[model samples]
Target: MASRSPRTTIFLLLLAVSLPFVCGCTDYGGQGVEQWSSDIPGGEAGDAVFNTPVQSAFTGEDESGTGFALQRIQPVMDGAAATEPRMFPVKFETREYEIDIDVNRSVYEGARTVDKALPAEYWYDEYRMLGYYSSFIGDPAIVTFLDDVLSPLERIRRSDNLNDEEFLELMVTFVQQIPYDSGAPVYPRYPVEVIYDGKGDCDEKSLLLLGMLSRAGYDAALLLFPEMHHATAGIRISTNGNPPFRTFTTSKNEKYFYIETTVPTYIGLYSENYEDAEAFVVPLGNGEKRFTRVNYVCHITESYQKIADRLVFMEATMAEWKQEIEDMKSDLQYGTYDTQDAWDDDYASYTALVGDYNSYVEKYRKYAEIYVYIRDRPYDIAGVYRRIENSNVMDITI
Candidate 1:
């Protein structure tokens, strides 16, 4: 698969039109409905944080107590170039890997101090400056840092004998494990700054993941959900066996599978909150690597969905059967029966209902076991397949 061209122009126009009116404040822990307007002239361009309204100027100190405001400010040149080696511990599945990188104080400060204002040409782009914010992923300074980060990951890949999909998941899980900075600046931070600060919001973390994946030779893009005021990373992977659960296609008809970076989630799984909202994909660099194990992931996702649906139906049926059995019992106790045969017939029917309910209970338990196994060992494709195959949950094979 080949990497596609950049769609900065189209992405900016979409951002301008989609996000006309936004709330002045946002709560990352909760999903707040944002007010939208289509009549606003020109675009309201702003930072990647998506919290502050375009009209509201940045103010107050961040949680770090930095004197800097959230608005676009001039870089404070301190002429410091000291480098500090830092270790970031990332946990994926049952294993924990420590990634070490040398952070340049000068680069980190420069990134923090860089101006975040959008160019004059963008119309109302300030509300979601995705095109502008994406530039940080390819910054010379950030690129250098990402190169160093990839070195250790490459070693881990060889040592663990991980396949392409597993390697990609490991890299993604690293970014997902980064502490989310609810009080981050309105502007998106450079990848270097995100690492040095040890935290980032959705946009900030997405940028970091994009850079890392791109540098590691994966065709990736940035997914912007303007309506939801959220962003996620996307990548081009082989969906040969089963279709992907969620993906955003560009005008050129290229599919980028959704990958949530702010929290730990399955690669192709998407959030239901923004599942109906429109999204735009901004392809990053041109890379050749593609995630080939999407078939395994799709099988697991499909089986999980089937098990969940069956469980729901079984629960509803059991509830109805229980109610019917209780009603028959009540009638037998309080209502008049014309004959003993009538009473015996009602009792037999009630007994049949009870038997059916018991049978469903056993089936439900079996399905639940399969569901839990897949949920817990999502990456263990063979194990999941064997568990499903051994039991009578459903006819699924990988």
Candidate 2:
């Protein structure tokens, strides 16, 4: 028996694959790639394909150069155990592509300071790398830690004329109190490290200050400098102040102050060394004591939609091949052996088909994640996609 060439086998497989999905010789799968349609049952009109029960879990990758853990606050049912819950799948199409956010404005009033003492646990756990990123720990514990240690600072909060010079003085005093260590453990020890040892780093001081200001009812954000590996938190300046340091006032017009959490006051805002750093600001959510702005955070979701779509398409193709092989086997049992040569030819063809099927199966089995990038900000979809695909997932910060 003679085997058919690989070209012939692939040609037949292609033909078998093309006949079913092709409608009038047109392809709907590859047209300008439509946004997720939200026209599914129980969905709003003109909505794109919407995924419900968005799984909120952390994923870490330490690929030498790339690593990041995807983190988000997900809704949890009361009295329910800690497990992945089921969600709905909604589909829709879009004429003009845009993400619809259901903003809850009723919750956010003006930012106010939480007058309670900062809890030492929240502050410690936030800086302590050991259980810092663990989901088991709640926000209250960390908040409490901040309150316990920074209580003194919060108590001293008064309605003062917070001018540029006064604000700089406060910043210098705070920085001078805390020590900076570049080699600190990834996790923070909080007041234990700062109070007892009188030492910490940019992130630690920032957290301490953040907890204090928030408790005092001042609106602030954790300003991140990724390139410089630093964090500085301060109130958002409402008006222009001095040239270097911007000033954002709190909910109380009288209580306005500028904060530089990382560096000592000696290195003023004009310190040219930290100029042009990559910076991002995350506004704190206003709770009972703290002032949280409505829709302050961006909704960023990363979907492996590209890889998922590819898997779906390939699986559909494999099913077609499997059906063909089954039909061929049926023919063999029915005494439809056209020739000995054809039988031998089918062996290699079946083998190659099996190989391709197994390869796709393996790919589908691997750790392919669908990152749904959601942010409260109007982000560039194309740019976001490019960053996720090109850079290490850890480098992706919403």
Give the number of the best model, judged by lDDT: 1
Q: Could you give me the TM-score of model 2 versus the true structure?
A: 0.32
**Count of backbone clashes, every candidate in sequence:** 11, 67
User: What does candidate 1's lDDT look like per residue over 1-398, in tens digits?
Assistant: 11233233321111122111111123332221111111111211111111111111112222454222323222345766577677878766557789876777777777777765433333233333343444465444555566666667777888899887677878887887788887877556777788888888766777788777766667776666655555667888766443745667888877777776655556666656555667776665556677666766676677777777776666656666666777788998998999999999988988887887688777777777777776655434545567776775685321
Least well predicted 10-residue stretch by lDDT in candidate 2: 30-39
lDDT digits (tens) for residues 1-398 of candidate 2: 12222232221122232111011101111111000111112211122221111111112222352222212123333443332222112111111111121211111110011111222333222222112221111133233333443332322222344333233234334533455655554443333234333555555555555544443334444444334444455454433233232333334442222244443322112133335544444444231222111111111121332333444554455566666665566655564567898877776676676676677555544313322221111122334445455545433221
Best by TM-score: 1
Error of 1 at 230 (Å): 5.2
For each candidate, the alpha-carbon lDDT, in order, equals 0.60, 0.33
